[model samples]
Target: MSVGTIVAVCVGNGGVPKHPVAEAKVGPDGLEGDRHRYHLHGGRDRALCLLSVDEVRSLEADGVRVAGPGAFGENLLIDGLDFSALRAGDRLLVRADDTPIELELFDVREPCATLRRIDRRFPDLMLGRSGFMARVLGEGTLRAELAIERP
Candidate 1:
């Protein structure tokens, strides 16, 4: 019953405020053009960040104004997956265009001050809803509307 699809792909050259992109190259380091301000943000174990559309919607319903996908610095926005149910050691297989990419969840992404700066209540509102940090298991190009497999 592994079923999910990528709804958006986002990347930023430096830090927070990542914007949606049509596609991106994912490597062992991370999204090709993306950069991290602190060492905590990027590395083999935290190469990519993922967030669920349902989580964002839930936040919005709670009166938190989310600017939309990428606002939380997520590299991939997926739909139909219960992000909360996923834990460390879980793996995700993505079929991006003709390329296949694999990622393993390492830990939950903690909300940062930057996220709180975006909205005063963001920190508390996004406490456990931030998303997950993952390491790249395979390199490939990722794009929106791609299918995602969880096993």
Candidate 2:
């Protein structure tokens, strides 16, 4: 069982650019209990970016740093989790209290020079060497304690 921690949480809309600054979402737009939502690639959709806790360390070590979820334009900054291992069409069980948001891994986020511009250390960040991305299969409350069931 791979364990991880949420270093930070962020949310934003489709207006700001160049590190839009993360925010916390309140009310029930599907998110639970004051959960913040981050907008990625414009307001085309929700569920922005994700990162592994281990990835956080990788970035920190490199000098390039990010807060968590939307910190560096990523919606989710997970710790000690491997995003690559979860492929497209894979169902991820996001558990929190009695609420569990089922997330489906959609695609492999490829690396780009832009990431390097944001943080020179990004190019080497966990999948940063390969780039990172994620698609939410379902929207709901996702607490710190949760696990993904391999489908």
Candidate 3:
């Protein structure tokens, strides 16, 4: 049981610099308050995006300053888990209420053109640190301080 903490819950209408919310409703498609501008960005396989705080720290160590929670277009900011240990198709269960919200980890998210706003080399610099895309398997309320596990 690789348990991690939800550092933040973020949402965006269409782009980067997503705003962090105290809590949000997770649905089969994605988080209730979120939406994507591009079609390729959203769907069952890529319903939500996740970012590892460890990765953010790595970037910060390299002098990269993340604007905030949604700067990377991630819906969730997680901490205390080795992202490399998780593989595609792996399921993440977030503890909440009576049931755990399930999320299917997809492949690493491809750095998009929007990231250029941060730095031209951001795409390349964040190669392995960009984090993974995910599909919601079980819907539930998401908020900070929640426990998420790779089970």
Best by lDDT: 3
Q: Please report how far candidate 3 places residue 71 from its true position, in Å.
A: 1.1
Off by over 4 Å in 1: none
Residue 84 Cα positional deviation in candidate 2, in Å, after optimal superposition:
4.7
User: Largest TM-score belongs to which candidate?
Assistant: 3
For model 3, the stretches where C-alpha displacement exceeds 4 angstroms are none
Residue 27, candidate 3: Cα error in Å is 1.4
lDDT of each residue in 57-123, candidate 1, tens digit only? 8888887777877888889999988787799999988977677788999999988877876778867
Report, for all candidates in order, the number of backbone clashes. 0, 18, 0
Could you give the candidate ranking by TM-score, starting with the highest?
A: 3, 1, 2
For candidate 2, report its TM-score.
0.59
Candidate lDDT (C-alpha), each: 0.86, 0.46, 0.89
Query: Please, what are the lDDT tens digits per residue for candidate 2 over residues 110-150?
Result: 44445665566544553543324444544554444445444
For each candidate, give its TM-score against the true structure: 0.94, 0.59, 0.96
